[model samples]
Target: MGGGCCGTLVAVHLLRQHHPAHIDMIDERIPGRGLAYSTAWDDHLLNVPAVRMSVFGSEPMHFLEWLRTHGRPDASPDCFAPRKVFGSYLQDVLNDAVRAAAGTCRFRHHYSRAARLTYDGRVARIALVDGERIQADKVVLATGNPAPFSLEPAVPGCFHSPWEPGALTGFDPDADMLLVGAGLTAVDAFLALQAQGHRGVVHCVSRRGKLPHVHTLYRTLPDSFDAAGTGGARGLLRAIRLRARAAEREGYDWRAVVDSLRPVTNDIWCGLERCEQRRILRHLKTWWDIHRHRMAPEIGARVGAAVASGRLVVHAGRLMGVEPDGSRLRVGITLRSQAPLSLSVERMINCTGSDENYRRSANPLLRSLLESGRIRVGAIGRGLETDRHGALMESDGTASGWLFTLGPPRVGGLFETTAVPEIRKQAEALASYLFSIVREPEDVPVDYFLAAGI
Candidate 1:
């Protein structure tokens, strides 16, 4: 039930597919409100367009159908709705999946941080922060994105982490807000502050001052992917580059480009050797993400309004340290100078997305897996390596039969794996892969009202 997008998507399909596996969802926060959706704040909005938030590609109108039935029939498909609403939508999908399952599955819920995971020859064990252990036939690492890495500074007042909710408790919006890294997280913090009635001067510091490009008008691309023939890093790149250039010449928009790339993303990712993947991350990742995963025009307009109205400001630099002055916080940032400037604020929130630096992670299970050479970081310094079947490869290059990673954690294998459309495919693929190992019962399609026995 954790709010992680990929985890919830997979769980929904797992139940819907009539797999006889008992399910257990473990996380530290609210089950349906993973980090993105957990925020009750009305200002933090989804970046994806509502039309694309369907549970699966097969059900293109799932979210649209949901909206029409739930009194939002005229809701603009291109608008970004509140994150809480998407959270609610996720819960609804889960409920529907449970109903569709017709008693084929059962689930256990745990509301605590997963401290570690240990595996013997046969079963995998999960260690929870609340001092509980869960053993299962299969363990999936759905640990979504983590907060961005903090800068090392000599001073004490530099607050580097964002996940600490207390950091924003009783925050004064009138104070100066010095933000580090001007990306999606920075935008989230900015909007959340406004929703909380914060009226402070916001200073967003980052290496580049460019913001994410908003999704333009949608233009469907030709479904021209050849997943079977693509192999080797260079081979994949050559194929994609030819198509991308063709896409541009054909006047394709962001949506079209992403749509065209969808079928071949995994194959392309796998074809790259460790070193090539790293090069892509160092150079192409930022550009790729901002262009590929675009923001809704409606939300983009709001962010633009914030910057235009003199309520927000952006700078290019790194945070050196942070200092606390009573209830107010003072942040030290090195901007355009050899020395650091002290900027004070009433609150600071980390919007830096997901933990990419693996060595600093304290999760016991991940640490154990890494040490045992069961999972190794790809050259990109972010994401775990996986094979075509979504099987995780440990550092020693052995694929675990009972362990798997479902979503963004497999970014090294599939670049665009976090969204619902992509995730639903993965969930179904994982199910099909697991079922294929031995003879399996026929699966009745979980469609039609009668199929759900409602």
Candidate 2:
């Protein structure tokens, strides 16, 4: 029911497979360009290399080939291209798929927000905020990530989400700004400010104040680490450390060892118990994120330059509060192992990352589904509960055949579902699964099947 990257890829795969079905892509914003690629800045390069960002699983060089055809013949497979360029490529791929479908399949794009969803014994009905309804035999929730957590209550000068269109607009270029988180989103904001030629000092605060690790040009190592032998998180950590040390001793970058873990991450995550998962989240998630979600080399260089020049200040602290101080904000911060301090900045931007808790979500569709018992929260309370194949689990302890989900909605079920490589694989698998269960269009009513005792 979304048209973001995950949704777009799924639709593209379905169409390319010539599935005899009409697909509906619903989204409030532009299709294909989700929050991640919606930025207009040229400096916002993709975190992942272009070679691994293909939508098709079998065609790994699809994105690179597209780049070569589109005036970027010099672009290498490992190049971190601008995100907007990728967005255009995705849009072009979708357009080409639509043309290839011809009269065999139909696609409808609804540029509207889905307010609520309800499923009867038959088809599911999606009610839009504009009072329109779409009935479908099967529905897939690919709603992507939620808005960043509102750490502090909304005030006049406090911005909760940095990605909100024009959120940084109209700010004085020379005025000091404070960012609440020091992650990728925070880096994006800092780059945006730099792009605008902002000369004022910028402060970024987080609990650890650790930016993402920089990506290096290195060959990936062979997958030899046995995840099954590693019992839990501690064992896995020990195994990884040993492998990294061995790699260092052999004159290979440690990142190669870490990159090799990508194939077995889900297996390792699944092996851990709920308590272990919680422990990892509480203690090691931040460290793991900084390493796993590294920044582009160019981006890292820019950030380093900014830091070296004293233009960007990063603080390891907890944001206690923020009060509006006429024409500015008084930010209360408590640094690690230090007393609280106050800083006045002309603007405060919240880049605290997505709020994974469903109960705290402001989306009406999620809330409605939760209240109706159509969907239940995940075991870790990070996202909706889904099975191994990304089918939604219901409140009555059964997986729904009519509803499926991918991307961030499956984060609890699959620890690494947010990235392009992971989401593209999921989309391909989902499309294959859907095609396997295909039935005649007239036989889509579940109630009829139940009545006949089929």
- lDDT values, one for every candidate: 0.68, 0.86
State the lDDT of candidate 1 residue by residue for 300-392, as single tens digits. Answer: 787788789878887666666666677666777777655566777765555556777666666566777788777877556677778777788
Error of 2 at 95 (Å): 1.3
RMSD of each: 6.2, 3.3
Best by lDDT: 2
Question: How do the predictions measure up, each by TM-score?
Answer: 0.82, 0.96
lDDT of 2 by residue, 94-207 (tens): 999988996788788889989888877777788888887777777889888988888667777688878876667778888899999899999999999888878999999999
Model 2 weakest lDDT span, ten residues long? 445-454
Q: Report the C-alpha displacement of residue 123, candidate 2, in angstroms.
A: 1.0
lDDT, model 1, position 228: 55
Q: What would you estimate as the lDDT of candidate 1?
A: 0.68
Q: Give the TM-score of candidate 1.
A: 0.82
Which lDDT value does model 1 have at 332? 72
